[model samples]
Target: MSTYPHFGTDAIHAGQDPDQWSSKAVVPPIVMSATYKQRIPGQPDLYEYSRSDNPTRGVFERCIAALEGAKHGIAAGSGLGATTLLCQLLKSGDHVIAMDDCYGGTYRFFTAIMSKYGVEFDFIDLTDISLMEKTIKPNTKMIWAESLTNPTLKYTDIEAVVKLSKQNKDCIVVVDNTFMTPYFLRPLELGATIVYHSVTKYLNGHSDVVMGAICTNDDELGSKLKYFANACGIVPSPFDCFLANRGMKTLHVRMREHQKNATAVAQFLETSPFVEKVIYPGLPSHPQHELMKKQAKGFSGMVTFYIKGNLQKFFDAVKVFTLAESLGGFESLVEHPWSMTHASIPKEKREAIGVLDTLIRVSVGLEETEDLVADLEQALKASQ
Candidate 1:
């Protein structure tokens, strides 16, 4: 048995043991069989079917669970798939309260797909404790939120939200810890009922795998999610699972560098004349900087800022930072959220929540901070 005593140690050794393999390989081998052989009548091996269980997928799930300090973990085909499976916990007419500034994909899922099934959702600014308290209906079954909201980098008070959920015993406080990850923040330790992640981002760190995961200390809830994942056939492939597990081994190291680069980038952007506003939880200028300090161990590589000139010129001038949609990788990426990641959201509604056209979101990578800052400086000058 492997001991997960610390974050860095657990990230590498959890859910993995060299002695378990017949070949005695140092790393877990990818088990790609669709079905396992039965040893007796009506009895099969550890995994009866790939959809329900696979050795590679199990290792990945267990590793994530251990990292989050949870008893169970469920992996999905995509981040949105995990979100969709989570909605299975709700039935007809069940109410869900989510943050207004959540990821656009989540908003679309809640409003478009889930609403068609007779589920109700209310998008509220979770920062306002009183407003969140007033919005909870008698039928509310879930409180969905992101620890650090996408693009905007707004912080959610997990403790406060958990307290509110306690008022209604049945209400499950589900947190999308995609931005912070287990390296920086473990929502399960903060009293959240569930924590989910887009493994395509930080957990994978290479942007090669598009997967999602759910971790929870609640055994029953974990079982339900696992069942839904099997029933819905939304589970990730064995190969993806293997890749995610490998990626997690270096998560602790990558996160520290990401945080260091992001802090420097945020500071640089804050002083740039071409930059209008910089929003990073690590910076004192952020509205929830102190709140993040209390809730998380460290900030992530994501940084959002507004530019002074034409957005297109700035987007076109960047040489080092790729103009991309996704985040949390080894190479830096920048995107115009209004037209990229958040485009699914109606312009009026998106703007109302502060995702403006001039808002540029940066996913600071492992590059030297000086080079990144110089690239941004030259890009700004060229745009001008």
Candidate 2:
């Protein structure tokens, strides 16, 4: 029997007896078989096929659920697939109350795509706890929010939203815990019924494996989601699941270094003359600094700011910070949401929602803080 360890230790050692495999290897072996043999005709099913379950995937699922304090975890081929499975819970004519400042892809999924399919959704300001109560509707089946929102770097009050959900048992509190990850903020512990993540961003820290996971503490909800995931046939390949699981092993150490570098970078940018406003919870100036301290273990690796000049100049003059999409990896990445990630949203709506052209979002890497700072310093100077 395998003994369980604390969350940090579990990342490295859990769910398996390495000595049972050849050479007594330390890491969990990837069981790539698509089907498992069942001895008896009327016996319980043992992985009838890979589409329903795989040993490698099961190991990763259990590990993630244990780490996040959830009863079940389901892995999907992509982040969108994970969210899509949850969307299956919403029937036609169901109402969804979502954060106004969400990942552009998510906004597009609910507003543009799902609407055509008959699901209705309304955008609400999740930062305001008081307004959230008013936004709830009788038909509202879910309230969606990001722990640390995309591009905006805004912190949603998970505890307050959970309180509101508790008041209304029918409303399922869904949190996108991608930014804070389970390592920092355990949404299930905070009363979130369903937690989702773009495993592409952080959980698969290497950025090599594009995957996502949906977790819940409810057994029935977990079974339903697992059914949807399998029925839809969107499970990740054995190889991808293996890589993602391997990445989880280092998540604890990687997130710490990422937060450390991000904090240093945010501090440097705040003092830079070219910077007008820095939006990082780690900084004292952030509106939700106190709230973040209460909820998150660390402010996380994402940093966004408004550059006080022409957007073109800032965009064109970066030396080291590669202008790219996606985030939460060892390499620092930067992008302009108004053009890149949020292009799906109309120009007027995007600006109104705070996706400004001059707003630069940075995913601080695991590089030396001094080096990252120097790169930014040069970029800002050159932008002028």
Candidate with top TM-score is 1
Clashes of 2: 0
lDDT of 2 by residue, 196-285 (tens): 989888888887888999989989999999999899988998888888888888899999999999999999988999998898888988
lDDT of candidate 1 vs native?
0.93
Stretches of model 1 off by over 4 angstroms after superposition: 1-4
Model 2 TM-score on a 0 to 1 scale = 0.95
lDDT of all predictions = 0.93, 0.86
lDDT, candidate 1, 187-261, per-residue tens: 998999999999999999998999999999998998899999999999999999999999999999999999999
Q: Which residue window of length 10 is worst by lDDT in model 2?
A: 14-23
Q: What local lDDT does model 1 show for residue 132? A: 92
Q: Give me the candidate number with maximum lDDT.
A: 1
